[model samples]
Target: MAEQSTSAESTESRTVLSWSGGKDAAYALFELGTDDVTELLTTISENGRSSMHGVRQKLYEKQAESIGLPIRFVELPQECSNEEYESRMADVMAEYESLGIERVAFADLFLEEIREYRENQLAETNIDGYWPVWNRDTDEQIEAFLDAGFRATVVAVDGSLLDLAFAGRELDSAFLADLPENIDPCGENGEFHTFVWDGPIFDAPVSVETGEVVTREVGDGKFHYCDLW
Candidate 1:
């Protein structure tokens, strides 16, 4: 864990952005100014891969570099229980609170339950949660992301919702046009996950090459994720 130094209390709040190294997160930071942001916080698996998108640590580092922010990665066990997840996250929040950080921003869109859960959790520590891309239409958001000059690739897809071939596919008009009606255009339902490699917010585009696809089963759900190196 990375520690932040304590500073004098101020009327203005100190904030951190929850980064997932994905298009949504990248877009959120761009849409929301970063002048008061403390750091980019993210969660990674025990093996140093992004817990959600499965992007490797090296690629994540490149993303942070391109976005020009210091990232703090919270490590989670390979097979952690929900209880452990909450405990670990609580500890991280407590640490940030001690440093005078008062809020964390997320990139959730049209997910009331998720936003509510995050707010509830943060309320426990007197910290607030901000959702920059909340309540937006998925189709419009995806189109805006592309029009903003961001480039991303589908890194993971829910095995039950999409074919394995969806992994490693560029996130563009063709990809969105090919998605089934049941799938959300912005992947807000977790039908798929993406890795943003370039965008207006990035100082430089991240260089990556697709690698072998790997599958993992969690509970009854399976995910097919492609590696990038």
Candidate 2:
């Protein structure tokens, strides 16, 4: 019995995934591991509130259970600016410092400025940024993320760059192939936003209904989003 148990435990894989309510991070985690990777999903929740990127804290709790992974949450405020963002990140890092987190990962793909920012930031800390999906052609990247058995919808779009109709549609090859040439296929320039569904990274898919397609004129441009519930 001891030998059998030891063998089973030996075969178990482990890793931690950075959580965001989006497809890029979901796909990165999918490629990294699928079965019980450390059981810990980490994310920064809204300050004083227990949610990540508008995801309910309880929902995340259920998600971790469904994936058979444990969860760790850090909270931050909704109106956080760049300085505040860094301070909160420092706090999270301090708590996990002794645990020897070999690397940290993100949902980024092919945005030079964002990548540079993350890399430079991590250079100041013990943890280093690991970009799993970087520099791939937009079509190929989107196709791969889709073909990897993951699903996602456009949760938001910058109205100035995209039509409001794009706010709540499934991300499939056809939609991607048909994207207007002027819009960045990956939305790297903030053309669109996504929420993930069934994928290799999830033991069970996240269930959400598109709530509302809202268009608001803010500053110099109008933005659109699909309220997800």
Candidate 3:
């Protein structure tokens, strides 16, 4: 395992990363600049699948083990309203507060609405919010992520915006070069989502295999997800 910085260890406030098992989140953890990470926080479906990425629970466990951190999976039903989601998250934040974690970090990049929502949600709570990669240029951000020796694969792609073939591709220079002009280099616009398998923050690589490419309708659009196992 990589040794943590002294500054991170000496801090008083316990912290947690809002882990999404994606490239941006992985890169945020790498640049976390603090060694006091208590746990990873993620949302999962009632059936135990990752809420957005749709990755299996076992893989998430493997990821946590590789990162040497326990994960808190907030379970919710497949379909939920914003109110229900917020209520469940508030409960989880209460638990974190009881555990003495006063801060939570995210990897959000230049999304005003998302940042506003997050900040507003936490405004009334003891636990504060952090955005590690707030407004950096998407191209530079992704190049830095790759240059830092992180390896990830595209696991989900918006079928409306991206070709199905883009799914399961590694997040490397070649892949970035191939992205359409409309897609964000860091996929900040939800054009794609990734799963990090190896990185500076991990003790070892998580082995995974790509499964079938399946399309599913979400709201008014359809998405093609490359399942990983």
Candidate achieving the largest lDDT: 1
Could you tell which candidate, 1 or 3, scores higher by lDDT? 1
| Model 1 regions more than 4 Å off | 1-13
lDDT digits (tens) for residues 145-189 of candidate 3: 999999998988999999999998998999999998989998888
C-alpha lDDT of residue 96 in model 3: 65
Q: List the residue pairs that clash in candidate 3.
A: none
What is the TM-score of each predicted model, taking all chains together? 0.92, 0.80, 0.92
lDDT of 1 by residue, 126-179 (tens): 778988888888889989999999999999999999999999999999998899
In model 2, residue pairs whose N, Cα or C atoms come closer than 3 Å (at least 3 residues apart or on different chains), thus clashing, are 39-69, 39-70, 47-76
- The Cα RMSD of model 1 versus the native structure comes to 2.8
Cα lDDT listed for each candidate: 0.84, 0.64, 0.83
lDDT (Cα) of model 1: 0.84
- Each model's Cα RMSD: 2.8, 6.7, 5.0
